[model samples]
Each structure stands twice: as structure tokens, then as C-alpha cells.
Target: MAGLAGTGLSGAGAVGMALPAPPAGPPAQVGGLRVCERGDTTYLLDRSGRVRSLTYARLVPDNRLWVRQSYDRAGRLTGLSVSWSGFAGRLLDVRGSFDARGRLVRESGFRARGVTTPLGSYLRAVPRGLTC
Candidate 1:
């Protein structure tokens, strides 16, 4: 995905959402990137202090979904993916792309059927330094 070009993620993702505060340990620095952990969630910040990626667990109804967000070099969100732990391992639920202006462009996957996309929610919840 275009947004993933400089972030090392090969899949689609983008944007940042409010996550719980980190527990106690300091953020870890790796190769100029800062990794912050809060419970089952992790946020990766680039050298310029932009969110590069976010991986977090979300509860939906009776299922627990793992969500990932990927951003471009400018810290603009581009794509998102959701998955869930299954008997066969992690099963993808939905994957969507966002236009540069943060509109949901395309989404697919069986679990995505009939569900309102969360693009607006994520855009509204984007954290301080990140852009949707």
C-alpha cells in the first residue's frame, strides 16, 4: 500500500486512534522509532514523532478483533485492517483503504458485510500529532 511505503508494513493501514495510557515502562526506541505499549496495544512513532503504525485489540460484540493502522511518511493515515484470533490462527475480518482526505475508499471481507465502516470514528479519534 502507498501509505505503508516507508513504515515497513506490507499490508494496508493508516490513521491513529486514542489508545489507553501506557502502563509503566518507558517507550522503547528502536532504530530511531519509538514503540509505546499500552495493554494489548502498541503504537510506533517515527523519528519525526509521527505515528507510523498502531496495533491494538478491540472488542466488538462477542468477538475480539485485532486492528492495525498504517501511515505515510507525512503521518497521514492510509489504510486499516481488522482480524480476529481463530482456531486456525488469526483470520482477517476486514481491510479498507482511505483516500488522502480520510474517506473510506474500499473495504472487503466477509465480516465487513452490513457493518458501518469505522473510518469516520477513527478520523474523529486521531491522536494529536497524527493526521487522518
Candidate 2:
């Protein structure tokens, strides 16, 4: 049986899974940030030229997810926020503050309009290690 790497599905017989390729065109420099667009998602680079954050939208469910990240001068993520929308305009928002080594130091959650906390699913969708 084949196993997937980094997806936590090891030994589950999953195989040949890969993330979609980024947009084919070159990234454009806007102000101090580099912007790359892939379909409905836009990735933003921090001052250190790292992919610091992104925002994506889904049409099928008519929802959107946005990630905000802050990095110190050395390019290590120090703060992160992952937020998503639900039906009826509800929202689930979570924040995480990380230490110098990227270990989460504090976590906070907020809800508006009685939305379900799909925080786990949203975090899983994120590119791992950037979560709270």
C-alpha cells in the first residue's frame, strides 16, 4: 500500500496526491509585496519575499477563506489569523501568536452569527505549520 507524505494519511493507501500548481504567469510586484494569482486565490509576499498570506474564494459553497500573517524582520511568522465564512454571512475567526521558533504561544477564537467552528477543517486546508 502506498502512503501520502505530510497529509497525516500515512499507511492509509493514499497515493499520487499533490497540490495544484501555482499560476503560470510571473508574479507582479506591488509596493513592497509580490502578488501571485492562481484561479480564485491570490498570494501575497511579505517584505522578506516570502509567501506570507493568501485569500481564496469558493464558488460552489459561496464561501471565502482569508489568512493574515505577520512576520518578524527575520521572516519567521509571529502572528496568524485564519477566518472563514459560512452560510447566512456567519464567520469563524481564529488567531494564533507564535514564539520565535514558530511554536504557537496563544490561541483565540471568535464567532459571529452562530457559525459552526470548522476551524480544524480550515486549518487542514492551510499549508500545514501555519495554523493555530
Candidate 3:
């Protein structure tokens, strides 16, 4: 076994996937962000600089899976979301806003069916552990 274990499921309506064993160590940091990897999975730290969100890519169809964290301006985490896209081509749209204190006040999401949506009234909140 590698540093991880995975389940391979197949047959009727079954999806085959790989699940890595968790990493061992304190979280790693890059710039102001903390980084972690479980096999091929990646994670980001919160403003308190703790691992708060994770992302992984599917090995079979080679799709991207995203796990994200939201935070207030004061550096407190407020919310989180997860999304995925496949080889057939898909765009994921997730939107959320935070208060001055960094608390997420509202959030909304929609699937992009070959077209992007207008910015409209949605507000974007930067996650704590990301460079942007």
C-alpha cells in the first residue's frame, strides 16, 4: 500500500475512486497560506492558520474537485463549499459574501451550462488560506 488507501468500485452505476490516507505532520505553509497533501489531495489553512479546506482530483476521468473556505475580514472563518467538474467539460460557480468582521453573511451557487452568469448582486469573499 502507498502512504494511502483507495477503494475501487465498478459495475452498475458504480464510480471508481481513489482515497488517500491522511498526511502526517503539522500543516505546511506557503506565503501566508498553510498547505497539506494527502496523496494527491491538497488543502488550505484558515486565517487562524489551521487546515480548513481540502481539494482533490479524481484519477480515473481526471476531474477537478474543489473544497473551499470563507472568512471574515478579521480572519475568522465563516463558511465553506465543495464542487467538482468532469472531463465532459463543466464550469462550477460558487459565490458568497462576508461581513466586515469576516463572518460570511450570505452565499449562493449555480451550475454554468455552457455560459457564465452575471455578477449581479452577489459578493465575493476571499478565503483565509489562499493567496488571493
Cα lDDT tens digits for candidate 2, 27-81: 6776777776656556666555566665665544767667666666566667767
Instruction: In model 1, state the lDDT of residue 77.
Output: 77
Q: Which one wins on TM-score?
A: 1
Highest lDDT: which candidate? 1
* TM-score of each model, paired residue for residue: 0.56, 0.50, 0.38
Give the Å error, residue 71, model 1: 1.0
The clash number for model 3 is 2
Mark the 10 consecutive residues where model 1 has the least summed lDDT.
117-126
lDDT scores in order = 0.68, 0.62, 0.53
Q: State residue 64's C-alpha deviation in candidate 3, in Å.
A: 2.9
Q: Model 3 over residues 61-129: C-alpha lDDT tens digits?
A: 657655555444355556656455677665565655555665557758866676453332222343444
TM-score of 3: 0.38
Q: When superposed on Cα atoms, how far off is each prediction in RMSD? A: 14.5, 14.2, 10.9
Compared with the true structure, the alpha-carbon lDDT of candidate 2 equals 0.62
What's the residue-level lDDT of 34 in candidate 1?
Answer: 91
Instruction: For candidate 3, give the lDDT of residue 30.
Output: 69
The C-alpha stretches of model 2 lying farther than 4 A from their native spots are 1-27, 39-41, 46-48, 112-132
